[model samples]
Target: MQLEDMTLEELKRLRKDVEKAIETYEARQLSEARAKLEAQAKELGYSLETIAGVSKTGSAKRLPKYRHPDNPTLTWTGRGRKPKWFIDALESGYEKKYLEI
Candidate 1:
């Protein structure tokens, strides 16, 4: 259809429909990618659920505690922080450290 023949309202409706279609396509692509990753993990002796658990819990392996480099008083569990540490560091001048490897 010619753009000049379409009314403003009609053009708006068409744009909305296109946007919805694009969103649906993106969601489907994401789902497919996740499924592929899960399949690969399963083949490598890890289930999707197990992988998800590890990701959610940081990792299944043990990690060493990290200390704040600037200030030795603050420490981390090597899994980022439960609460934001940047603000605390700014306020308390506590240095943050993380696992080197």
Candidate 2:
């Protein structure tokens, strides 16, 4: 319909309807894009976020498995390279079983 043919109220309602249609189209487009990206990511065995260089915000902390004999605060989960405390203790005739928590 021509803008000149519509009253002020009709124009306002048309504007609102057009805005709503735009929002719906935008939402649908975003959903489709996300799905396509996810499918593309899965072909490489990764999520879209990871493939895009985004790290997970809620990465979990590792649980400690070994604690210092004298200081309970000093603990290691024994995942990566051994720390100085762990290496020193092993060098001083200490066995790995002794540090088990």
Candidate 3:
């Protein structure tokens, strides 16, 4: 069937079918990858969660290393993205030492 010859409704239906196929394909691929990784982790004497640094509850949280200068309540663990307040303080010439808790 030629897409150029299909009506708008047929085109929409085809698009939906294509999306479903892509999703199923991606899900199968992801499951296979996870199973392979789990097997590899088991062979190395470690569970997949331990190899991935994850706990049953969740990943462990790091301690906060920096605090907002003006707000005592606002603090950051200095891990992921820097908070806006942290960035603003650095831009305004406030050294990291000044923000250390």
Per-residue lDDT of candidate 1, residues 1-101 (tens digit):
99889999999888866654543453345446667988999899997667766553544554324433334454455555543544554454333322111
Which 10 consecutive residues of model 3 have the lowest summed lDDT?
Answer: 22-31
lDDT by residue (1-101, candidate 2, tens digit) is 78999999999888866654543453345446667888999998998778877665667555466655545677797888888887886785556766655
TM-score of each: 0.34, 0.42, 0.41
Better of 1 and 2 by TM-score: 2
Task: Give the lDDT ranking, best first.
Answer: 3, 2, 1
Q: What are the candidates' C-alpha RMSDs?
A: 14.8, 24.3, 16.5
- Residue 26 lDDT in candidate 1: 38
TM-score of 1: 0.34
Model 1, position 76, has a per-residue lDDT of 51
Error of 3 at 15 (Å): 66
Off by over 4 Å in 2: 1-58
